[model samples]
Target: MATDPVCKMNVEPAKAAAKVDYNGQLYYFCSESCHKAFTEAPQKYAGAAPPPHSSHQHGHR
Candidate 1:
């Protein structure tokens, strides 16, 4: 499963209706809206490295 950059929801790549590839990596989105969100401000989510996350410790992007 992949994560929605906008809502941070777990999303299955096969179930995703939209996606974007950046920096040679693929990002799966739950919907077009999330895809657009990630596409528009990729820098916000991409420029920095995200820390590891857990259910009790959600990581920052």
Candidate 2:
């Protein structure tokens, strides 16, 4: 699973229908709105480092 950068929601990497590539990193989103928001200014949202243990245990940004 991966965290949706726009809303900090849990997104299954294999199931996400919305995703964007920013600076060579992949960001998954829960909805089109979230995806568009990130698309507008990817650098602003793309730089966000997930919370501690986010790669496993999820948390807010």
Candidate 3:
């Protein structure tokens, strides 16, 4: 399972809605919206460390 960098949803690479190769790493997305968002600003999500638990909620809101 791979985490969709845009939405943080778990996705099976084989069943991913879209996938992209960036900086030698592969990223999977659950939907085209996510894929488009990532493509537009990969540096915003790519290689970005997951937020700490305490601040995680802030992102969702």
Model number with the top TM-score: 3
TM-score of each: 0.69, 0.73, 0.78
Q: Write the per-residue lDDT of candidate 1 for residues 5-61, one digit (tens) a residue.
A: 677789999999798888776878888987887888997875544534433454545
Ranking according to lDDT, highest score first: 3, 2, 1
lDDT of 3 by residue, 1-61 (tens): 9999999999999999999999878999999999999999999998585435647667776
User: Over 4 Å off in model 1, which ranges?
Assistant: 48-61
Best by lDDT: 3
Candidate 2 residue lDDT tens string, 1-61: 8999888899998888698777667889888998999999887787677445555644445
Give every collision pair in model 2: none
- List the candidate 3 regions with Cα displacement exceeding 4 Å: 50-61
lDDT of each: 0.77, 0.81, 0.90
**Candidate 2 Cα misplacement greater than 4 A, ranges:** 50-61
* lDDT of predicted model 1: 0.77
Question: Which pairs of residues have clashing backbones in candidate 1?
Answer: none
